[model samples]
Target: MTATIPAQTGGDLPAHNITISEFGAMKALAILSQSGKENAGVRVFIKSGGCSGYQYGMAIDDRELDGDTIVHDRGVKLLVDRMSLPLLRGSEVDFVENMMGGGFTVHNPNATSSCGCGHSFRTDGAQSPDGEGSGGCGSH
Candidate 1:
């Protein structure tokens, strides 16, 4: 079960999108249910300045913005704002477990280079702010 939410066009909003795997969908549902909020959902976004030029941010939210792309899957809603959609388009949200632990992982196809941690990534040849190494979620 794979699903994608594409940002709307012809509006004063940004256009970006994201996909989710079955595992990710189920995990989102579980998390939301545990939060005890009837309208709780996950908000995924991108912020500037990581080890890479951009970084991912996520949190459980109950409010919906004016220009949010909502992906409904497995009884869970994943929200992506207009400004953050473009950077996340074609990316996949997944959940995995390892000896270290488990969490949601985003497989972004737009990434040109990523760090060893798989949390932060670069899409173009953009350099880090310090002109040294980039940092973020990890890498992909």
Candidate 2:
């Protein structure tokens, strides 16, 4: 989650995933543009749902509480809520523009299992496979 990314330039656009360009950052910018809010953002997190165990939820909001962790990437800034951060610690969110399944995808190394629907993932207790889920996995 604390990966160090070199600064971005107007010439070199930042990147989150190979398939989808600026997954979270682009989504954040898009949300800001629509809300017409100067400092708004898109928040991505996992919730207890779907056929598996957890599902990805995204929303556009213009509010920031005290315990939010912000990830600034590719000229776009995103705010991840405190509660949600635990489950999504080291996940790399990607945007996949595919005919079969095209949308923002979370490359969660923590998840032990992910449903075939590309949503809902489950991880072991405190330890994920890759140890990225230092915050522990969310429960249903």
Say which candidate scores most in lDDT.
1
The digit string of per-residue lDDT tens for model 1 on 48-115 reads 65566666778899878888878764566788888877778767778888899988878898889776
Writing each residue's lDDT as its tens digit, candidate 2 over 35-86 gives 8776765577777665555677876667776777666656655566767777
- Residue 110, model 2, lDDT: 69
lDDT of 1: 0.71
Query: For every model in order, what is the number of clashing pairs?
Result: 12, 2
Model 2 scores a TM of 0.66
